[model samples]
Target chain A: MVSRAGVDEIRAILDGVRDPEMPALSITDLGIVREIRQEDDTVVVALTPTYSGCPATRVIQDDVVRALHENGIESVRVEVRLAPAWSTDWLTPRGRERLREFGIAPPSGIVDGPVVVSVACPRCGSFATRERSHFGSTPCKALYRCDVCLEPFEYVKPH
Target chain B: MRDSARIEYVLRFGDGALVLAQRLCAWVAHAPVMEEDVAVANVSLDLFGQARMWLSYAGELEGAGRDEDRLAFHRDAREFHNVLLVERPNGDFADTTVRGYFYDLWASLALSELAGSHDERIAAIAQKSRKENAYHLRRSQDWIVRLGDGTQESHARVTRAVDELWRYTGELFIGDDVDAVAVGDGFGFAPEALREPWLERVRATFAQATLDVPPDTWMQRGGKQGVHTEDLGYLLAEMQVLPRSMPEAVW
Candidate 1:
């Protein structure tokens, strides 16, 4: 399946590969696509996991390869990188908007130390929200409830 | 430098993570509250991920054909090198919380040191795991304080859990030849060195919780040498059943 394609074209195709856990965001939008390059006849895509134990990692890898293959270029390698580890800071502006539109609060504020975020309600845009649970349905999310709107939602935890 | 010692040292940490991860998984649908169920499982998942990385590296260091899957699913209880602390049963909410609190306190420091390891791969794994472990440490600490200071019943239960679990804490910092080679060779943390700092935090947390630190007693040891309690035997039986029975089974 080893073939060749322009790096930019390959990147665009990758943007269509949605994260299985968060269907609203692409790998690129999540900033897990660290690099895309060609080496010897294989297109290498460097990926970093948002959480070390994220179950979506394997599915996301398969999706990346399948999406690239569907576009005609074949040989693809999904290299997992752990260093300079993935951060909430890497989430793109568009990804943040997409997360809010999907009723999930995106990570906000500084990432250097402890995350003391004041998460606004994605639905009512109210700041009267409180964390219900530090862990949610997924490893990267925390459950929150908007007091004003009385709606429970997921907040992308700042890591 | 003989790779054997390094491999064994790595297995000690990996096996602890794996065994503890398995123990936490047992709490999935059984935790008292829905939020706790999710919380425990999340921590379990993180440890599982760390176990995979550590075991995969150990396999590579072994220069064997085995990998993370082979090492994890195939090993018997006698072959595991985890300390005794992690294999303790999830007795109650207090028991589980105390067990995790002890480990998190030590892991936060051990991982911080490992993050600077000369072995780059080990360093990377530690660097990545430490960030996640920090949150775990905070949560467990909070639970300890809340339960210890909450009510007469809650305080009594948590105090009893602490007293029962305290003896297991000694094995974490006590080391042998495997540690010597790992630390002497500059690839591992000095286990003995972590005790004071670990205790300092433990004392501070206990003070806030209004719980007394248990007096030292004869410590239980030997899990690192592959001599585990009966609990590990049952744990491995359940964990390895699928892999041992259907080696070729795929999801």
Candidate 2:
């Protein structure tokens, strides 16, 4: 079992971590964390991203190090996991609700399953949203515009 | 055409990337030079990743219960839609240079066109793949000229490879059902517009490589319809057998 202190440290350190573009939220809130393990004095944090070509990876890594260092943990290693590819469905319940409130639609379908359903537009309660582009502001999100509101939004393809 | 065509189109591009990646991977431990070897491996990884995306998307488009792995492994050689140029066995270093030269010229423009695809998925893949293609093109261009102008032996080898692969270049721009689906859905545009830049780049590269450019003669086309050389059978056998054998296998 992980020590209470270790868990709390992780939570504390991660609290300061903000996404490069969406600064108001932390990665923990984004649901990018897959697992965490500690061996000796080394902390290995395994992470998955919504997409492989995430441009903000460097910033995320830097923030991870900064957060840990400030808490007296200087030699932490942040390892990235490529398998079990992240899906937007990983977004936390609160994150999804927050996204809806922020005027951005939450993910439409469950990525792990095969059932396809129409995506709903957050701006307007319409099933008429369409994807405008696969690559968005960051590599992970796709560009989508709601036909109802006609407002283009950045969708977080949750990791 | 049915949505199945869309799946095939995605597969064709994916198989092209996967096959090329396999060939490039061959140079991982045996590149002509150390740095070049590492670069080749890195490029191979990128190609492999792109292949995964294309195959995955193709599977989704097909809605036939096949994911990336099944699509990759279960398909027979005749079922694959990759062009002959990519499947051409990697020869000497000069041969490799020529192969890359031909591909980069077409890929540079194909990706640029794809970046604007009406289909968001294709466009997204295009956006990322285009950046990689840009670098790959530059790298190939640098070497094309260097090898083309290098010693007599290097020049001759590169020239031979270029000539042999020229016939296959026509297959790149031919559109089919998948193109239709993407276009019909208002997600992409005609790939024919890519021919000009592709041709210009090819002409420039050939000049720099010290290789005489092949005349804009009548070109043969067929791969877009899935007709491939006999060699593809052996290749598919190796690339797909394990996955086919262990159908449910997953890590």
Tens-digit lDDT string for candidate 1 (B66-126): 8999999999999899999999999999999999999999999999989998888889999
Compose the digit string of candidate 1's lDDT tens values, residues A22-123.
Answer: 899999999999988888888899999888899999999999999988998778889999998888899999999999999999986858966576899999
Error of 1 at A91 (Å): 0.6
Q: What is the Å distance of residue B210 in model 1 from its true position?
A: 1.2
Per-residue lDDT over B137-190 for candidate 2, one digit per residue giving the tens place of the 0 to 100 score: 767788889888999988888888877878877777667667777677766555
DockQ of 1: 0.81
What TM-score does candidate 2 reach?
0.63
Candidate 2 CAPRI grade:
incorrect
Which 10 consecutive residues of model 2 chain B have the lowest summed lDDT?
B216-225
Second chain of candidate 1: TM-score? 0.98
Docking quality (DockQ) for each candidate: 0.81, 0.03
